[model samples]
Target: MLEVVAVCDAILHSPWLLPVLVVLIAIDGPFPVLPSETLLMSAASVAFGTHNALAVTGLFVAALIGSVAGDFLVFGLGRSSHRVLARATECEGGLSSWVRRHLLLRPGTVLVGARFVPGGRLVSTAAAGRFGLDVPRFLVGSVASSAAWSVYMLLIGLLLGPITGGSPLLSLLAGAVMAVLTAGLFALVQRVRAYRARRALAAAQHPTEPPLVLVAPR
Candidate 1:
């Protein structure tokens, strides 16, 4: 806790912190392990302590822009090399096999929910690119979602100020909770995917099985 507070104080006082924050957000859009929310919350807490409202707002906007830019870039890459990516991954077979075996078959909720899950954001973004979703629509959704996420984290930090006696303990606790929740959600989603895949395989293997006949005759 002392270490976290020290780091936060340094970032808030440093001149290069804003640029570092932007870089971290950008990298997080392509890499799943960056923990964008923790960074945002930490930055927000620092800004709150220093009364730097403008800097805090800028950080949020920058994060949203970075997310949209990265997502769009991947989308374009997916579009341009659709054939190559498909061939490389063996589109019809390997891709489908992965989707089934790893429980990525149904991505509807997962795609939207990924923005909230640590380590899942990039995977979901890459999956969206691979699936050929409309770029403009995706950008709109990403911007909105990223902005909302940024604000939520900032609020978390502000709220923690009162609860933890102005300590950084709340920020660390929030990060831990987010991590645990994300892991649980990911596990549940995979389970659902597995169940769905098994059902599909069973149906395919026994297509000719007649429906059970309910006989009321004597």
Candidate 2:
């Protein structure tokens, strides 16, 4: 515990922490930085232990600004290829299809919901632009999702503080486990939903087609 405290103390005092946090979350693609979530959780856990309201506030503010900035960049990238993307996704299925058949119809829900899904953030934001979703609507969804996700992650760090004896490292490790489980659960739900949608689509396409059944072999 002493060692953990010392390490966290050093990290919290580091002048580079906040700058690094903002930079990492604001930029995307080939850069060697710890996952933004990990850094945020680390800072949050330490703040939780020390009751550093400033740190928590900083994390939230950084996350909000950085996330929206990054997302806007991706959105712009997608917008640049808007015409090509629209042509490419004219058919149904895949991300392109989702953007056309679904996402286009429910911009706000998909944008907000995507924040919780792994890789969903970039994909959805990009799709929004690729599909030419209204800028005003996108901004609303972007801010809302960023706020919700920041709070969600901070809450995880805070909840783990006491459980890990106020050790930021332990809280970070525990938070990683929780994050993985949460991501896995979300992924599973997405897969299941996709599978069901496929099945329904198939059924509609072939009303007279026989259903397949499987049996275990000895």
List TM-score per model, in order: 0.60, 0.75
Give residue 20's lDDT in candidate 1 (0 to 100). 68
Candidate 2 has which clashing residue pairs, if any? Answer: none
Residues 99-209, candidate 1: write the lDDT tens digits.
323324434444445556444455555656676566655666667666766677777667554544433545455544655664788778767777887889898998876
Query: Residue 145, candidate 2: how far off, in angstroms?
Result: 1.1
- Candidate 2's C-alpha runs over 4 A off are 1-13, 28-34, 82-96, 102-105, 202-218
lDDT of 1 at 130: 70
Let me know the TM-score candidate 2 reaches against the reference structure.
0.75
lDDT of 2 by residue, 1-218 (tens): 55644654566568777777677777741122345676677678777877879888988998888888877877787788765434543545545456555676787777777778776676677778877888888898888988888898789878766776667567657656776787789879878988999899998998885777888898
Best by lDDT: 2
